[model samples]
Target chain A: MAGTDDRDVRLVAYADGELDEDAARAVEAELATSAEARRLLGIHRETASLLKAAFPESRYAGGSLPPAPAGRARPGPHLLARPWAGAVAASLLLGCIGYGAGSLWPAPIAAGPSRMLAEIAEYHALYSRETRHLVEADASEAEHIRAWLGPKVGRAIAIPDLSAAGLTFAGARLVALEGQPVAALMYTRPDGLPVAFCILSAPAAGRGMLQAEREGVGVASWGDGTHRYVVVGEAPPERLRHWVGLVQRQI
Target chain B: MADESFRQALTRLLPRLRRFGMTLTGSGTDADELVQTTCERVLGRAGQLRDDTRLDAWLYAVMRNLWTSELRRRRIRRHEGIEAAEAVAGEDGAARTEDRMTLAAVRRAMDSLPEEQRAVLMLVCVDGLSYRDVSAIMDIPIGTVMSRLSRARQDLHARLAGEADGKVTPLRPARRG
Candidate 1:
């Protein structure tokens, strides 16, 4: 009982200045008489100082890396942004795939929906389950998001209102796909299921909404005069189609 | 421009975040990568972070969550090839060459700790975070944070005194039949 874990916790918390004033004064009074309490407190404080000393402040800031915007892998700039805009949606089948997220599928360097799915599978990897990190740009600032991404994506992107489909816009971010920038918009259902809608830039390959499934994830894609839209997630087939219809009509 | 405030906070916290990342990942490149990803997540989710929250604590929480997610991806030693961890302090100066040895011992004792203990130690002892802040960051209760810190400090003292890295050279061995 003299040196129990419960006793040590109070002593340690006091030493670390974590206890409130009253608790700390109690620890201090107990420590004033017992050499053992003083000794343990000293040891913990010494260890704390040692940890701080070993890692000095600003050790990395004295003219080191200038805040690299990101350290994620990026390919050469020469590689052009491709037409199939839905790079990340194909991997959003996380609810159904039930495997690990961000698994690198060795999709060969080809074109069209298959290639885009493989390229941006990583977006869904980190988009795994963090509700907050579901997107880069908050949906509240829809106008600014459109302004920032439209030019870079080389198309007039639309922020479709998916509220009728019971989906709320989360946010959007520009993701790289096959060495090109693609816009990935995120929405979530009340049940906390996340769905990604990606719009890619390309020429007039006009079509209406079409339904398909790839790699166990539901996909609905359509191409307009300037971009291809894809909505991907793991949902009932008809439900996926219904959400796709909502996006199609709004955009 | 929308993320201006978050970006400034991130820049201010880069060193500490990177140090914490290094302690967890044990590689400079890996730590920087982890920090950058954490930064992106923080700025990306800037909406979720209310003005009342401390940015430093939020950055740490995001980084810790990212590291945890990565652990699910690859299961192995979290601080692999960390023998070079002490080399980071070498730039402090050459005047205290002996103190550098002490630093190395301290670092080794730290790494030898269980992951849970070491993480709590770094958060509480090194970062000077209150137990409550550490609890919020680690998502554990305040009492748990205190016990872990107590255990980690005690373990570090025991290890560095004579048991670990030949720090004391064992005058006559510390075992008995």
Candidate 2:
């Protein structure tokens, strides 16, 4: 009564049996006095009765359930034991894996002749190794690494100077990629965590870069007209952005 | 104790549960899938069901959530596989001849109602659940449940009435040759 409308709300409450003892008496008294109120009550009662009458009967009569579809066996122990069932299951699993792999990897032939594999392999090689002072050039000389690697890949490659990123440059490396040469730059945090940057010429037109993650490692690859670059590391995605931005500006 | 009781309760409720699923989905196949998924989810989280008395509400909530998610996923996949046939014959024409249009329309209307309204209407009208039982199942104050039921009835009445009115006036007449 406090939050509800007096007329419409009271009738609804009365209809739903929500009116308490005194409230019910008051409503009944009102209904006796007001013919219109009684009519409203009648309509409410009729609507409620109609709704109840229209209520759908239970579809699943205890024993009237439809038989399982033809050839679609019930999920019993024997169903799983059947050779055909096993074959069907195996085929379904294989189809799912194949579909996922096809979407992810695409046709290797359609991937175009590029240094993607070599770059990924290089990134894998350097970061996977266990050593200190593993980089040829220290983080302090970010400019030198950019200049040295820029001309070799036939692009103005800039080693994303990320000293502020809490990661120090471990230096860059020249690696053979797709019969042509490319650059693989390495970086690490003070705690000896590693990140790799691989840059080579871009693949053919209409080809998009791919990103993949495996075993907590994120590998992001992209290609501009001149060069394709992949940054592989265990750093948080934001840090990866910093490295990508550094490469983007220089290239 | 709760888990054992919940399992027993679910098994007992399975028949009614399947009926609710069938009414909601309008397809026996889809209903079976919905019931199976609901059972699996309830079984998987058996330990989390603390109150044996509130098992019906818990199961209904799980079923509702699962159905909503399944509908969303189906919307994405519905575009493929039948495109060519659907494109050749328009959806309206195809639906008109199928005898499924009325049921489909009813289902759509029910689905389009607000979740609270739909739940109340479904429980009270479809499942024949008493207002007291609905209040317990929804875990709502009985007054709130009553309000929802009132509003749901009004909305459904308006929808059904509008459909009837639209049908009374024929938009097209048969041509005499």
Strongest candidate by DockQ: 1
For each candidate, the DockQ is: 0.14, 0.06
**How accurate locally is residue B20 in candidate 1, as Cα lDDT from 0 to 100?**
76
**10 residues in a row with least lDDT, candidate 2 chain A:** A91-100
Q: How much does each candidate deviate at the interface, measured as C-alpha RMSD after superposition?
A: 13.7, 16.1
- What candidate 1 gets wrong by more than 4 Å, as runs, is A1-3, A62-251, B81-83, B163-177
* TM-score for all models, in order of appearance: 0.53, 0.39
Return the DockQ of model 2: 0.06
Q: Give one digit per residue, the lDDT tens place, for model 1 in B1-177.
A: 246766676677777886777666554433544565565455545677777787778778877777776655444332332334334223466548788777777766666666677678888877888777788888889878877787778777887887444555322211111
Model 2, residue A49: distance off in Å is: 3.3
- Give per-residue lDDT, candidate 1, residue A221: 55
* Worst window of 10 by summed lDDT in candidate 1 chain A: A102-111
Candidate 1, CAPRI quality class derived from DockQ: incorrect
Best model per lDDT: 1
- The first chain of model 2 has a TM-score of 0.45
lDDT of 2 by residue, B121-153 (tens): 667655556677777766777777777766665
lDDT tens digits, residues A1-251, model 1?
64588879998888777778998888999899999989888887888898888766555442122333454322222111232322232222121211111211110101123333455454654684667677778988788889988887788778888999888888888877657676888888877468888877743322323344555466655555356677777677778878877886788
Count of residue pairs whose backbone atoms collide, per candidate? 1, 0
